[model samples]
Target chain A: MSPLAENSGPDIIAAVIGLGSMGLGMAQSMKRAGLDVVGYDITPAAVDRFVADGGRGAATPAAAAKDADIVVSVVVNGAQTEAVLFGPQGVANAMKPGAVFISSATMDPAVARDLAQRTEALGLHYLDAPISGGAAKAARGELTIMASGSRQAFDTARPGLDAMAAKVYELGDEAGKGAAFKMINQLLAGVHIAAACEAITFAAKQGLDLDKVYEVITASAGNSWMFENRVPHVLAGDYTPLSSIEIFVKDLGIVQDMARSERYPVPLAAAALQMYLAASGAGMGRDDDSSLARLYAKLSGAELPSSTKEPQSL
Target chain B: MSPLAENSGPDIIAAVIGLGSMGLGMAQSMKRAGLDVVGYDITPAAVDRFVADGGRGAATPAAAAKDADIVVSVVVNGAQTEAVLFGPQGVANAMKPGAVFISSATMDPAVARDLAQRTEALGLHYLDAPISGGAAKAARGELTIMASGSRQAFDTARPGLDAMAAKVYELGDEAGKGAAFKMINQLLAGVHIAAACEAITFAAKQGLDLDKVYEVITASAGNSWMFENRVPHVLAGDYTPLSSIEIFVKDLGIVQDMARSERYPVPLAAAALQMYLAASGAGMGRDDDSSLARLYAKLSGAELPSSTKEPQSL
Candidate 1:
């Protein structure tokens, strides 16, 4: 794959249609790269944050995309992405002919393909670009992007893409492949997080020291990226929703749907989804995914470290 | 935890009871450190190999431990450990008074405690020392050992421990605690391996490039130590039992038993265990743990890299 070019940004008008943790950062990154970047979000404060960060604020996606060469959609999932592109006040009709839309939502690949088809039919390019790295990486404009699109789509989104990402995997010349790659990532991430929680809580149940467990497992073959990152929350007895249980609940649910449609039994991903569902159902939908340890503790009467600082109710 | 001292080996007599892959390497390491190391195994060829490696070979645990100050049992599980210590011609009675028994078998903590008590009652010490790092680490004398025992036990076992292990976590001053830590590691390891297999196979089902998935994942948050290490075997269509599927079936089975006894449900481990069992039932038990990917390929009809070179029958 030819590397996408950087900083055509000086002449590009970029629209970022969401300004949550990730989107806000992307907007600032685009602006920093010298793009005339305008941002909009459902949350006014989020858009205002981007504006305060020196981005132009728009009242709607249509207004954001009206004169934009590239529109970046960074909503939560496929439905919101669809709404951003085609719902009332959507950007599709407002986008200039031949302008590109880079969709950074994680969803079923089939959904990604459908959105790309609809977007292309409107004389616009759609780039399926699902991102990795956390919000911190996003804020630093160093996200890892799994992207697939036509050559023209990549060309049009190149400036904004280079501004917001450290690594861009050009996965295919179609929209669905990047989303498929991202789903594989989500399936593993969700399962690993759940496995880490299950393992750590079982350690607690066995009366093994949690801190020592962390030290040992990290150095051992048992370690995972999620375990290393998320176990600190359990060790500190902090269940702040840095990345909430509901995120996996939604992502793994999509994996289940995608696998089901293919008539594939994804036992591990399915099991992980149920645990996330259980965590969410237990009012931890918004808690850190590591809250699975707390759920296991509550269910098994195991003594995890108690925290007076955490909220008692969801 | 006081660091166990190195290579007091010139004067120490160390016996390794079980000359398997791990045991043979450990014995060689002990011999290299100047210990008078004797080794034994049910399989005579293993003992022959150890003997060829400049160590003495014995026909029984008792014979191996007879003049030894430290007896290291590197058998598969608690039952083998128990048999080595108390079966007909076992080491507990054969070992010198005040000698230490280092049990490196992964087992239930309760069994470890029980074995420690029985050995101590016979005027010997038992160190619950479960080892990690694979055969290569063992050969390099750089294994990570999670160990616990009385001060006297640690003192007696120090030379052998230092000779063989790069990092020895002195987790507690009792026999069971080290086993507890080891089981926690196993729980996560088993689950992570199963999840990695599930993920790569699912990616294959999605028709995503397996090599690309590996490239993207190891750099992403979805990565685990297992995924990075084991996926290559899948990519090469090699299922060489580097670490067998049966290993996780056994480890996760142990985890399930441990969790169940505490009435703690480890759904992810349990789910992962089911996948390992499925892989094993499909006659991949003795195949590498990554064979779960092959199992997924079989059940879902996904085309993972295939090998005419791989065995087709159990």
Candidate 2:
């Protein structure tokens, strides 16, 4: 009983139900890996863009999932994920029986477990797969996936997972565990980025060159993956949204909620959440997350390096 | 003229004014470099240990400073650094007129500037040099030094600096810049460690294996130099103090003060300081800084992996 054999034909038909940055890149990766991939997005421009990039595009989630052997929901949050799967014109009923549904949204682990049980009852496999590494890695097919599911769900999602990820951590045989792991990553990532912003702006206030601070820190114990990746943007004064301030505001909120449910006191994550909220509330919601430094600078009255272009509205 | 020439007859008499972990390793590095080095500590046992390690020992700051061409003050805080340099029977009045003072204590930039001015007024040079890379790197003579001073101060301190550090960042031609850079590093380092502890302990609460969390995080974007360095200690349940919780309590205290003086709000460092303070208040002050995870674990009521040995007092 091959997982792919559940479809009408031998070929695996994959449908990516989000054509955002991560989803579009992952759709391209699957297409480039010679899988038959169809992508869909609520925005027509994104769907057209995916189609223009030599991949098939669908008009709706139901239409895309009508024959997909694997349906990957790469949307933003639990609400969006649930809407795509169980709302009007939802994909769960559209997906073939025994097909796998890979949920890659960052949501509560409890939500993932509930979705897995619901989808399993519908005779569809659910693998809780949350991703890390940003847009560039997603496009290059090098994202890290923390995935968990039953054996059959893992077996079903393996092909698409292998095509899209450089590393896939099979965390457990249950759906919520992958989500748990991702929350942990988000906790650290959020805190590190906020810390980098705080330190760099503090350095700027103390009259240290931002570039020099970046150089010294990356070579020292203070360095983090977020610091090394994002501080360059601060040094260059680039606020282009590689990842937006709102993303962390959302993710760290989820982290705090999870921690609260567990009665875990994550003071650092809570602190980081406040910084993200500050940045977002200060009209930097859509700016590069590195705009955190700008928030710090604005609050401290410190001067940062000018950007290469005219400033965007704060 | 060579700074070494300021000492008697081609011998560069170097004195290490503290014999704690970092200071002891640095003293050994200088001794291995063949400088005539003398180490001093308030603790007689520490001084005896240094003597047993084939290094000369001094009973007081004056005895260590007398005739020394380079005096490295590797004490704990601003007050201690000031005491070693200017207390009753202090080093300033005992050193050769042209001798250089290399300050490795993490302190306020203003204090470093003031000390440099005071030392220069006494016909001595001062290099505001603060070190990073913990005891292991110090032992291998591979520490990173963020240093700033006058050209002559840098020139005067070069021999001792070269012996103890693999990388020397000459930040500026002023005394405070090095301390400024160091405070920035401490801000990031302290926050990263707290974030790592928060993430690992959160994972533990989620029932994810901590060792796996450590493995995944190091390979993920959540990774930091402190995370990679300190998390293994948490996994091994080893609370042996490579660095202690109190170190961050002091360093982040400096960071918070710097931020407050600049009117900069550093929420992440402030939050991290609270975690360290909480850990210290919980009586884990002398344990490894990674004991932060234990603090989180205790607070969250999560069971951590057992250590190979009997538990130390919390």
Candidate 3:
């Protein structure tokens, strides 16, 4: 074989240690990009589905990571990420030296820094790569990644990063900056969604048709990407959880935590976070983030469309 | 001229009092539509500008309204609108019978309703037509008018409205609902603008280039129309007062008052109102609304673009 052919050979092994929405898609993308990808998940169905999509299934993190060149953690939170990397039977213990870990979760920057320190001590590279774009983008291998790490780590993880992300922002040579950027992005996303819901609900209260309000706002300066994307879910009365209310609860909670630590007053983000918390507590946690409109419906005594029957009439 | 052409002659007289940004352009659009438009302003220079733009000059609202078929109040706030309409030298006492009063000031719904009742009692029609789409659109006769009133009122005002607004939301056959919808629109608009400032400011604190943030966010779900529109003003450091910070202080104060009366919690709106109030307190009341970004810069110790100097670092 030519030297180029040898360089592109199947000897490059990567592991994805979680196969949830983001992770499963990422695993499939990696596999389709011609990498020998080993995916492991706590749920057998997730692993089976990944395998069905041409992924190589591994029973455990150790099984997945043994001698692997990279391990990508796309779990729910930093805690799950920590467990996958350093917990009992964790991949870090089994992965080869010089293997890089691309941690792509929206997490506290400090936690990312801590994870970086811990992984580096274990003779591994850690790339703080917090991703944006939702699951659909993830499935299409078109995610935007806000990443920070050492040059060697980026070099080691280049192929996998290129495969997974359409645009990767090289934030800095530190672990926490990527997380900071993601937090800022989350702050705007959450506030825009909540504000959109408020406008539509206020329109409803004013007796203008909600549909017309949605249409006008799209044309007006009141429009937002979140508003345009999420309001339709409210209009359709379909809460099929493209991104759940709990996700904002987590993301905004991180924002609030960051603000508190920084002694910053994030009143809008705080209010939005509370609304997401209220939505989750009201048992709409699994619903789409657009279900935030339901909170407005509750406050105004208005009705919203629902998939089944009447959705308890708000 | 033929009888049909003679019947459609420019005898349909109207006036847009207070030749500020929105008012001046609206007056021009009226003149361009072949109406006999008499423009009035307290500022002699504004009157001069109106005269230069093919508008007949009037020293007072009464003078403007004497023979006019419609009087559009495009003043600042409720107090100014009241002064323009019912003050000692107000136009209501002078407007011709069967004429329409298209009130385009952003005022409280209750205030609008009261004005409508009074205007209607005077044998004049009242359309609660609060205008949007800023100065450029106003000049192009493409402003959006959130209007509501009786069918008779709509009919009497349709010619003037047709010359001014590109799209008109006929909310209902009530006076207050148009103002209510405008207040709600302002609530979301103010909050989203402030939120955009906050997020961009936070990103700047994290050392991301503000322009890049603007570019990515415009393409991402984090963006709002306010973000895409107003942020450029901040980036250019051009606070040329397209819309002043005090506008939001008044609008959001109205929103809070209305929300409080209904016992509705509008935390995001409330937070945004305070920020605008802060901007006002910081002596930016007359600055562009995008100057709210300055508050975040002051708080976070992030350097903002210079007003006089080009943003060399960007």
Candidate 4:
């Protein structure tokens, strides 16, 4: 679908129902864009932190949605999204009729479509809007959002989208397309990151200079954005999670589920999923994704820089 | 080692002992740089074609090396390189003493070191150089050469390298260093190509707009140089061989061998190699490396654009 045209609207009261790193940054971005933002999170400390940062906090998602013109669900998956909308004190009955719900969780496209259907039945619009660009860009209001929904949903969510995204691809006039596209991106991302880790660690195994390998590769055809972005963490031996290994374990697990249902043979993605699983299984689940290199290092007894605050190994 | 410094040579003559696309291009590049270049190939037609392209052609490697100051062997692997240097009518003894032999084949590092020892024992310089940037870059003298050798070897090969390479990385002062780096690159390159093919065809199976996927992915973190360069071929359904599947089969085979000997587990490269092998076995051995997409399409019954003169599917 062609992207929605440049949109404008009257005052928007936005409810951000999850003040994690990504959601908090997105909430601040909405406030900066002149939206009256209400934040809520299951963690009271998180809600307190958001309120301390000068945004109002709500006792529950339902409370946050009560006065919201748009409710942005920035939770992790379909289950959490469903809970926020239908659990005790759910936002479905609390929000005004015609108020839009924007789901930014990465979940099964089928789940996204079903959520859209249920939300529409409740006299609300649902936008399947899965976000990219991580927390830093989230804070900068420069996220890339892949979204699909009806024209009414687009109109209702325009203010939040404009505030939160640098690029919003309006995929279609229905849900699921955005989720499918996000899943594809996730598949490639997972594969590329694992490949990069494999390359760097294997280079280390060969006793070649890691920095030179990085230089030559970035200048050569073997480079990916993941390699360029994540290798520094490996080189530093840092395992502090910029994006953890568990994220890919979950994302690629979703891909495997989706591909299996479709009977699609995604050999590369499947292979990549194994690497993430192995890394997560090796107890690096919460470590940076580049820790796949550390996994290889541990398995092969190939030494990487032990320059991290604490050394990471098997 | 730092790249060979700029040097002046007195009437240097170079021999290119391979008239394939890459060798012909390198020979032409050398001739363009004012080096008198003579070319040879196993296929008489290739030599004839080179002669037809305004070049001198030799009957054999020895004949090509007879009056040369630098011999560049741009063959396929260590075995071919050994044949060029020591087989019947080999170039090793035929070339003048002190003339450098530059081996631009991807091979195991141990094999490269062995070949370097043999060449050096014959009172000659052996520069372990494996090339990148495909035929177009070779034709334009813009190839990137990862090279390592003695200072004398660098000085001896400098003129031809200046003509043939846009960037020559002086990896170290050893013959195997270049080969090691090249293998690392091949490991990543092969994996990326296979991953790109898997991603696009998988995207196709999901009924995505392939063009839009190309757009979104190139803008997203999932992108690799291979994906950006190769997916257009899939989008157009053209499996015309830009680089054949067999190339990766051989390269990744070498990687498997190296990693096995090193006791390093290269699961990602190993996985990628299987896809290339499967594609080759499925009769795409000479088709574009991107034909992995064709394989996925065949296996999953995914429909891609059949815009090519010939449809590509099982």
Candidate 5:
């Protein structure tokens, strides 16, 4: 059946039940793609902003999700997602039967499996569709989605999926695979950024000009997406939190938990986690993820860039 | 005066002693660049290869250095370097007057400075010129040389340096800076390769098809030079040594020493060092650095591609 047919049939409207960086972007993308988007957030400003952006805004989850064809939960983690969908006055009951709920947060695979089973019991489809790409890509509808679900769920969610992501990796006809893939991506991304910071700061301490090191590394084999993206923040000394140190504190924690559960020893991931923890503990948690480079500078007593420099860190 | 004029007038012919992966490649590059290159090694087979490749092969360091303008030591480490250049029956006393010595191994920067001072006091010029690029690039006379020396030393070694290196980073007119730059490069190269291993192995553990993961990552920002170069060896399950794990064990050791002396903490480098150490301890020191992924697989109890699957891990 055509994806648009679902809305004309018994399918309800679509609810984007968060208005954070990623959620607001996805909501705009869904609206742009002609989905009936209803956005809600705990803060009135978020709801108002969604309304200002041509998406319908509601005061509460129940109001937004009532009769919704798909409720996309894009909150911080399992607890926030659970509260939004299954908490007191939550949206699960309000979402129409046969509707699909796409969860796009990076969470534990076990939690994903559990959520999938719970949503399935409600006669709803649950597609674990954790996403990548930062805020800009999200707003442009160019994110990458790692998704898994039954064929019916895939069919039910494909329109919104296509609207929200540029690349959709259909991991399997199951829930946890999406979460697993997202976790793997997170593990590498986090480690690479932290390693870039360590290497650059160490270069600086060795008396190599930070800018020269960045230039050569970017041109050489030592470069990574994270390295190319994050080292400028070090050279510019800007620590604006595009992604916060706490994000890694959370993400690498997920990696460590997964590895520990599987008896997998990931020493590099573990070491990188400790460095992020150090950054967060040093009152830079709210600063940009590039602030982790500050941890290297702090430990080495090396000088980093300051506001006198340009503001482009990423 | 032109480099040739200086070399021909009271000229010193330089012998590169080692003729291993880097040495033979460099000796050939120097020969192609028209330097009076003499290549030496303990292994007659390697010496034969150097001779066949159009380099002058000498039986002993003394014979190689008797009329040498420069002695380029390209051995494994400081000990081999010192043994070939400054030990009993060393080439230091055998070298013609006003000759230069260029140390090309990745050793402690302190050693570079010490050697430079000692050699200069002995009325010989010294240029600390550490080379980069693998054997393939080296053989094509396209290596990157991190070099530093006094004006006379630089002038003296310019002929040979120009012949062998595509990029010569004139770090400073000091001895240790070249070694420092090399240590920084090693820090990034080592960590990047290990991080790539962690990433690709994690993808495998997540059940994403290895080939698919390679294709996607190569297209994505996750790609790095090391990732692109080394991952194929893992996919093929061929661990034949190209750049061996033992190489990192030594290079990262130099980085660690550099960091420790400078009190610069390098958690990422440290973590990567441990993985190489594990690979070495597992008796894979002689295997290609790509075998690092197998170390990750063994630690995680994940199945690696076997000989039945690909026959080799190169």
Candidate 6:
């Protein structure tokens, strides 16, 4: 029988590891759905914030995993995910047999399959569930998840998935399918953001108003979700890091690595990755990814719309 | 006094030069709006089609310009626009003085300014009015025009602009601003198409279905206007050139030239231009712009979804 079949009620316990921006929001979403939720983070402040928000906080991943029916790992990348599940003070062996472990990091498909196999060997279900929609959607329980796993794993995680995501695309019955889909999303997202920056800064170079460029492009054939979402930051001259340049540096790097392994040439994504690397190296890695416009302006000596404050350098 | 002010009536004679896809539709739209519309094209068949669609056809550029109050040049680029205006049998000295000349070609801002200055010297008002929304919108009289020029130029062209465009963004009181805005739009459009091709092909490499990638991406942050509009062609394996890859080679070539003049680095647009150039070199230049996906698949040895017919080679 499945763990969900065994529970058969609202008594399922869920633990959320890596309670940072995305994880804390997911923990709150689970708590709102009436699951007994425990949250842990490497940063103690994040755990304390989650506890103050009326969820349980655990000191370690193992403590959080103890007796949990589902453990959702929302870490940064494959390394962090592996550390949380199989590192020293890891939670894999601590989770009850038949429990589902959901991996929500952007990772390589090969790495995802390896981790899934390791989790299954320990009598736990592994669902490859990489997320989209950023932290704002995470807080609203309105994320989009590209997920794949065994039938039993889907059945076991459906309730929590419902609590966390507005749309959960069941891509396949394999462990790495979701990760592959996420890599594709990241590839487009990263490229679009870089393209937006390039176009807007080019507009700046030509003496067109950035605000007007944003207005016209949004209603024209050139528009993208990233363009509409991120151009405002450039127009307002804010680099407050809703998503950072470093994120694309990491995500598009993963895309390039995977493409290399597959012998595929992703020239657009590869080009976009270099822009993010340029921005990150210029000490704006933690700023809003829209800092790409600033980087372009600095390189070309074009004046952008004045910002409220000078951008800080790392 | 402005030509429109002298007339102060509904009577205006408009000629559309270069009756290609966009120009032909725009000519039809002008006729539908009850203007005295005349059209000319280098291709005799295009002129015949315009006449069959209930518009007058002209034998040459001067024939189209004779007695016309507004002349709209919807040619391919700066060269074509200049050819139709100042070449042997050009129309610069043929149109009535104080009549408007609307240049709808995507050209460099400096070239647009030069054209505007030359037209003004010939006692014709020049409006740098480049259009968007493609041929369908042109036919519906629902295009978006990014326009700038002298007040008299705008006044003379207002009636035709109303008949042809749904939104006319008055960008500035100069001749180059409209062209600048159009270049910005082309930069994004070209890059987004290339990005879409890269992402979809990467998905194919990962063994994900292209149709499913299309579905998921259209609903995800990865989506762009080009992705939503062009991926259908890829999915159906139809490359019957709604817009050809060579168009980007020209358009993005303009973008690069403008960027080079400004000493601005447009890495994304540059990268996208390379993809389009590669496609063109591989004999898919006249195919749909989405053939970048096919090129990537060929390069990586990945099979795409079965098409209705085999892709043709040069």
How much is B75 displaced in model 4, in angstroms?
1.1
Each model's DockQ?
0.80, 0.87, 0.56, 0.77, 0.55, 0.83
lDDT of 2 by residue, B140-212 (tens): 8999999999999899888899999999999999999999999998999999999988888788778897878
Q: For model 1 chain B, give the 10-residue run with minimal summed lDDT.
A: B1-10
Q: Provide the lowest-lDDT 10-residue window in model 1 chain A.
A: A1-10
What is candidate 6's lDDT per residue for B1-314, written digit by digit as tens?
A: 34343234448889999998899888888777777888999999999998887678899999999789899999989999998899877889898899999999999999999999998999999999999988899999999999999999999999899989999999999999999999999999999999999888888878897777888889999899999999898788778889999989999999999899889999999999999999999999999898988888889987776577865553
lDDT of each residue in A15-88, candidate 3, tens digit only: 99889889988877776677778899999999999878767788889899996898999898899899989898
Q: Over 4 Å off in model 5, which ranges?
A: A1-13, A309-314, B1-14, B219-222, B309-314
Per-model C-alpha RMSD: 4.0, 3.5, 3.8, 4.5, 4.2, 3.9
Q: Model 1, B172: alpha-carbon shift in Å? A: 0.1
Between candidates 1 and 4, the DockQ winner: 1
Assess candidate 3 and give its TM-score to the true structure: 0.92
- For each candidate, how many residue pairs have backbone atoms clashing (under 3 Å)? 0, 0, 0, 1, 15, 0
Model 6 lDDT tens row, A187-261 = 999999999999998888777888888889999999999999998988888788898999999999999999998
- Which one is best on DockQ? 2
Candidate 4: give its CA RMSD in angstroms: 4.5
**What lDDT tens digits, residue by residue, belong to model 1 across residues A1-314?**
11122223357899999888888888878776677889999999998888786677899889999999999999999999999998999999999999999999999999999999999999999999999887888888899999999999999999999999999999999999999999999999999998888888888887888889999999999999999999888888888778899999899999999989997888888888998898889888888889988888888987888766856443
Mark the regions of model 4 whose C-alpha exceeds 4 Å error after superposition.
Answer: A1-10, A311-314, B1-10, B311-314
CAPRI-style quality class for the chain A–B interface of candidate 3: medium
Instruction: Give the clashing pairs for model 3.
Output: none
**Model 3 stretches with alpha carbons more than 4 Å out:** A1-9, A306-314, B1-9, B309-314
- DockQ, structure candidate 1: 0.80
For every candidate, give the share of true A-B contacts it also has: 0.90, 0.98, 0.57, 0.83, 0.61, 0.93
Q: For candidate 2, lDDT tens digit of each residue in A1-98? A: 44343333448889999989999999988877767888889999999998887777888999999998899999999889999999988899999999
Q: Candidate 6, which CAPRI tier?
A: high
Interface Cα RMSD, each model:
0.8, 0.7, 1.7, 0.8, 1.8, 0.7
lDDT of 3 at A243: 89
